[model samples]
Target: MKILACYSIKGGVGKTATAVNLAYWAARSNYRTLLLDLDSQGASSFYFRIKAPAKKNLGKRFLQAYGQLASQIKESDFPHLDVIPAHLSFRNFDILLEDLGKRKNRLRQALKGLKKEYDLIILDCPPTISRLAENIFNAADIVLVPVIPTTLSERTFEQLLQFFKQQDLSRSKLVPFFTMADARKQLHRETAIAMRKRYKNFLQHAIPQSTDVEKMGKYRTPIDLFARNTQANRAYYALWRELEPQLKKA
Candidate 1:
């Protein structure tokens, strides 16, 4: 399976939204997709209307019963897409990961059994640069870095690049995309131009800021499903098209 991790060091940049929409599009295109909500806040799980299991020590339970992760897949109702919901238990998962001493590969080891079951596995990562995030980088085939057209977002992009440079990875697999963009803003226009000039070949499609995107969480549906005629839907469709060539090769 091809693993795509939608991530950002900073929050509120639409990483979860991108993951949800892309997974939905992948399923709609006839691919068997799996959306793994890795964020502790459970926002992605909430967006998909999946209820997270209640328990304070559930992350510990998960690690102890790692083999059961696959069994949980049978409970989801989306035809071609399955979801692994996140729970509040993950708030303490980081501490457990640290105590385990090999935290960087914890997620990688947990996901090895699922490689053959999905055509595309999208990870909705938490907004942090922890060992869990590094594990995601190590496991992902392609890392889609979402950046807003702002100075703070640009700084995060640079930090991402620096992080990648320190790791052993295929640099060509790093794809950058603009998220929550307002084209009419001078800062947005300037930032986009600068990003294109610096990372021309690695840049993917840009997703403009729209209310439709924000509403995906409220509707508990993807933009493609909720408002197909809107600009947001078209943008996500274009992103899927752009991603097709790379996905097919996997």
Candidate 2:
């Protein structure tokens, strides 16, 4: 199975939106897609209208009962795509993973049994460089880094590259893209130009900032399903097209 993680060191850069749209495109293309919500806030789960179970102090129990957690994920109410909903229980995941002394491979181990069931797996990661994040990096075939066209966002992209370099990973797997772009702003234009110049081959299609993308939250649907005619939807379709060959080969 092809595993892709949509991630960013900094939040509010449309990582969840990218994951949701990409998962929808993969499923629409007749691939068995699964989107795992790894963020404790559960935004991806909420966007897909999957309500996480209400319980406290369940994180430790979940790690101890990994099989049951996997089963619950498989039985969740997502149509063509399966969802592994995240809850408040996930907040302590980093601690549990570290305590187990399998910090770097915890997520990879948890996902071992799911390889045969999905053609594509998209992980919605939280914005941090923790052990869980390292596990995601180690497990994914590709890490899709979404950055807004700003100096701070560009710095975050550089930090991500530095992290990858430290891990001794191939830079080819680091696909960076601009999200929430506004052409009217000079900084956005300048930043895009700089990024294209520095990481030409690593750059993917840009996703423009649009109200339609934000509306997906209220609609609880992917942009492809909610507003196909909108600019955001078309942008995501372009991004999906760029990703198609890589996914198929994986």
Candidate 3:
């Protein structure tokens, strides 16, 4: 199975929104998709109207085992899509990973058993650069980064790249795309153009800043389901289309 991680060092860049929408699109395309909400805040789970798994269901290791993780999978309202809702216990992930000592790839190792059941696994990761982030970087086949068209976001994206370089990680696994871009703003427009020129890996499609996207919270579903004809929905569809071939190759 291919693993796509929706991640950003900086939050509020539409990372969770991207993950929710893309997983919906992937399932719509007939792929067996699993959306894993790693964020303790559980925004992805909340968007799907799913509750966090109880502590008892997680066992003493906090569902660190593959079977425990798989057992936590709950079906979403959408067909072909399932969710592994976030647990409050996930807040201890960094500490747990640190305690494991040499097991830097623990998350990757646990996810292996899930490959048989899912065609694609989309991770809704928290915005933290920690040991859990290292496991995500090691596990993901492609790390789909949502970069907002602003100076601060650009700097954080650069920091992520620097981290990858220093750690000797494969930079090619990172595929960044512009998110919440307002073309009407000269700064946003210029930043998009400049960033695309600087980073050849940026996707061609950019999700526009739209109220329709903001309505996902009110609807508690993907924008595609509630605002299918909107530009934001179309952009996400285009993004999935663009990423599909790369996913297959990966």
Show where candidate 3 strays beyond 4 Å. 56-63
| Model 3 pairs whose backbones collide | none
Q: Largest lDDT belongs to which candidate?
A: 3
TM for candidate 2 is: 0.92
* Residues 1-250 of candidate 2: C-alpha lDDT, one tens digit per residue: 8889999999899999999898888887877888889888999898888878776666666655557556657433445788888878777778888887875766766676677787888999999998777888988888888989899998888988898899887777778888999999999999899888988755567899899989998899888776988889989988988988976664
Please give the distance, in angstroms, between residue 116's alpha carbon in candidate 2 and its true position after superposition. 1.8
Look at candidate 1 and tell me the lDDT of residue 25. 83
Off by over 4 Å in 2: 55-58, 61-66, 74-79
> Which of the two, 2 or 3, has more TM-score?
3
Location of the lowest summed lDDT over 10 successive residues in candidate 1: 68-77
Which candidate has the top score in TM-score?
A: 3
**Every model's TM-score:** 0.92, 0.92, 0.97
Candidate 3 TM-score, true structure as reference: 0.97
- Whole-model Cα lDDT of every candidate shown, in order: 0.81, 0.83, 0.90
Clashes by residue pair, model 1: none
TM-score of 1: 0.92
The collision pairs in model 2 are none
